[model samples]
Target: MSVFGGMSKGERNRIKIRVRTAMATQTQVEGRYLGGLATPGDGSPLIDAYRRH
Candidate 1:
């Protein structure tokens, strides 16, 4: 079973947005300092995109 199977779609989406926002913020900070750190997951494309907004 999916780990989030019991969650409603809205709940899952909310979680995803929250996580994405946090990651995006982190990426922004790292980018400012030119820190060569790798994010924990899938790099930071989502985060980088979000920062454009």
Candidate 2:
């Protein structure tokens, strides 16, 4: 069994929530940075890829 198998349900849930929160925060920061890099009226490929998501 994996390490999580030994954890209580509540503990497992808390860990999952923390991980999701971290990922979301990182994505938001990345979005802002990419937006700043993007220009008005037809951006570069990097900006296009970022907005496509």
Candidate 3:
């Protein structure tokens, strides 16, 4: 059995929600540091770096 084999459905959903929230917060910060989010056609170096991942 895996380490998380005993976790309930509710517990798993909570974990997923927490992870999604954290990722969204991180993306917002990255966008701010990259000179605000821009369209793909902007062709900015910062946006390029952000889109690399």
Model 3, 1-53: lDDT tens digits are: 55466567668899999987877888787753324455566674434554656
- What are the lDDT figures for the candidates, one per model? 0.68, 0.67, 0.67
Candidate 1 clashes: the total is 0
Residue 49 accuracy (lDDT) in model 2? 59
By TM-score rank, best first, the candidates go 3, 2, 1
lDDT of 2 at 52: 50
Runs of candidate 1 with Cα error greater than 4 angstroms are 1-7, 32-53
TM-scores for every predicted model: 0.43, 0.43, 0.47
Number of clashing residue pairs, candidate 3: 0
Q: Pick the candidate with the highest lDDT.
A: 1
Winner of 1 and 3 under lDDT = 1
Candidate 2 yields a Cα-based lDDT of: 0.67
lDDT of 1 by residue, 2-48 (tens): 65675677698999999878778887887533345447575654346
Q: Which stretches of candidate 2 lie above 4 Å from their native place?
A: 1-7, 32-53
Per-residue alpha-carbon lDDT of candidate 2 for residues 1-53, written as tens digits (9 for 90 to 100): 56567577769899999987887788788753323454555653544655655
